[model samples]
Target: MPHPILTDLETIASSTAAENGFDLCGVKVFTHLKPMTMQVQIRHIGGGDVSLEECASFSAPMGEAIETSQLLNEAYVLEISSPGIDDQLVNDRDFQTFRGFPIEVAYRNDQGSELRQAGLLHKRSTDHVHLNIKGKINRILRKDVIAVHLTRLKG
Candidate 1:
């Protein structure tokens, strides 16, 4: 059988994302924007966080990449920007990068309820992240993490 031509929307969207300088592009599941819009977070090695200015800056080129791809020609909303404050923390690397900052993490606890904990990001190993909760610390395995993020603590 002839190899099937790759026509999955995700594959095309990912390609467009890379061409537009996005380190990662994933299918955002929730659509209601009930809390916030799921986003495409871009991480540039050695580059600083994607600022609002940068997002606006890349708008034209990013749109061009998506438009030229010929993948989705309809009026599908193309959001070109940085990962916002409400975005989820994905892994140990994310913890490592945001170390020393306050973070909110969602993970399954011993009881299996989705638990949300906030603390200072302490350390990251290959498989776990160390969080300093108040003065005490706890190491959480990566697999248990449903989400994590740097949170600003207002005094």
Candidate 2:
């Protein structure tokens, strides 16, 4: 289990991100760094790429909140950014929001080699996803998809 402090930090970060017109994607603490660092990833609530200016704006208040709450005993580096176009489709909200978009799912083949399946995400359910690939509807379990990423189209 993650430390309670981490969860508290995530809450504060989430509130700050929401105020900044973003959804809190995730919060991570990297203890391997020299002074330790906290990374807070955010995504635009309405859907779009988050710019560096937005990250800066979001970081300032989040840092202040962490400092005010004394969430960390010592100074910790804080980083903020969008989850990026290729971030994994982990949660149901992600699957719903990205429906109808082209995505690439990496799965293990019979030989255990990594195989990729490209398709348009038609829909999703609690346990599986419906994909339109090669003019056929392929129903795949969420677990079968090792990684699901948005496929950036050339045109």
Candidate 3:
């Protein structure tokens, strides 16, 4: 379960992110640190890439909103960032969003040997992941998959 404060902060962050043309993807509040810490992850609307300048541009308004809310009693650190280009595909949304994009799948074969395959993401079923390599479709069992990651190809 998340702390109540985190929930409230997420609401505020989400609102702020929307005002700045971003979608709030994640939020974390750490109270264990000396002065506390808040980390926010955001992505541009319409699945566009997020730039560092955009993150910096958003920080000011977001910080102002947090300050105006008076949600924190003490000093805290606020870090804003994007989900990143090379982030692993971890959920159904990720699979859907990156459909038809290049990806690398790492999995274990029947002999327990680790293998890797790269291709255009086709789709993910309940029990398998399908990839289009060249003109052929390859399907790997979900249970045997280790990780699926977005890959970049040099032009």
Candidate 4:
């Protein structure tokens, strides 16, 4: 979990992002590093990808919002970026948006080894997700999904 201040910052940033046609994908505050950094990941509202110019355009207001909020105690690097093609499936919207696309899901076994599956997203329900792995259909409960990301973007 992030600090309460960071959560507040995310809420503020989300509003700013929405007004400028952007989706605030994620926010992180790295306090361990020498100079703490606040990384903000965003995507274009229309979808596909986010461009460098779009990130630049959103930076000013985002920075101003952070400053005005008085959330940070010292200087920090505000990184604005696209969530990218490999963004983790964090919510229902993500599962629905990438439906029918290729996703690689992975989980850990009892021995701590990682197992992965790659296939088309066949279905998503209230409790489980179906993936067409090879020619067979595999159903995995939502709680068991350790990691899910689009593999088609990997090249």
Candidate 5:
């Protein structure tokens, strides 16, 4: 279970992202560091890539919201960024946005053996991920998936 403070921070960050026409992709808090660190990832809500300028544009409002909420009593570094192109696909929005794009899925089979497969993303369902490999659609159980990532294949 995540800490309540982390959840509250996520709520504030998410709301700030939405207000700025972006979607909150992820939030991570690192308490072990000297001053602590909070990293927030955001992406364009319209499915476009997030640019450096956009990250800068979001930083002000995000920082203001966090400071206004008074959720963190201690000093912490707030890092705002975009999930890079090669980052793993971990959310439904990513699956939808990258539909038909080339991807690689790393998973474990029923025998508990690790395996990797590359294909075009077909769709992701509640229980499985559908991939189009060489004109055939293959379904991989969600439980077995270790990671799914966008990939670029050299021609």
Candidate 6:
């Protein structure tokens, strides 16, 4: 279980993010830096890309706010960022918002088989998604899509 201070910090961060026009904001701590100095990542709720300018704008005030607060100590370094285009589709909200955009899903077929499918997002409900495949141009309902992700299309 996380300490109460951590939870409180999250709430503060969420509120600050909303006020700063960030759709999503999160804090990450790393015991060691492997590929980068600080492993901090922030992304949109629907997995859209965030620009470097946006990152700077979002992080500055947030960092200041956290620093001034008495709740948290200086144990973790803050890294602010935006989500990349090809991130995983985590929630139904993402699927709904990205409707009509290209997406990929891996699901189980009607015959109890596994399948990988990619196409435009037709619709997203609570537990299922309707996908419009590229060639067929018809929506396929996959109830057990184990993973869904947004596919970045090139111009």
Off by over 4 Å in 3: 85-93, 100-122, 125-155
lDDT of 6 at 126: 61
lDDT of 5 by residue, 1-155 (tens): 66569889999999999999999988999888869899999988887888989898889999999999998889999888988767789988889988998999999998999999999999999999999999999999999999999998647
Every model's TM-score: 0.70, 0.73, 0.64, 0.80, 0.76, 0.60
How far in Å is the alpha carbon of 42 misplaced in model 2?
A: 1.3
Ranking by TM-score: 4, 5, 2, 1, 3, 6
User: Clash pairs of candidate 5?
Assistant: none
Per lDDT, what order, best first?
5, 3, 2, 4, 6, 1
Q: List the residue pairs that clash in candidate 6.
A: 43-83
The CA lDDT of each predicted structure is 0.63, 0.83, 0.90, 0.82, 0.91, 0.67
Which segments of model 1 are wrong by more than 4 Å?
1-10, 13-17, 20-22, 25-39, 51-53
Q: Which lDDT tens digits does candidate 1 get at residues 9-123?
A: 3455466556756665244423444442323445543445777776666656655655676654335454556555656666545655677888888899878889888888888
lDDT tens string, model 3, 1-155?
A: 67568888999999999988998888988888878889999888777888999998898998999999998889999899988667788878789999998999999999999999999999999999999998799999999999999998635
Candidate 4 vs candidate 5, lDDT winner: 5
CA displacement after TM-score superposition, residue 134 of candidate 6 (Å) = 2.9
How many residue pairs clash in each candidate at the backbone level? Answer: 0, 0, 0, 0, 0, 1
| lDDT (tens digit, per residue) of candidate 4 on 57-112 | 88999999888888887978888988766778776778888888889888665666
Candidate 5: residue 21 Cα off by (Å): 1.3
RMSD of 5: 3.0
Please, what are the lDDT tens digits per residue for candidate 6 over residues 1-155? Answer: 43446566676677777776665534454445442223335666545677888888877877777777866444656778765567676666666668888888888877878888778878876646777775455444546777777887645
Model 4 residue runs over 4 Å out of place are: 106-116, 152-155
| Model 1's TM-score against the true structure | 0.70
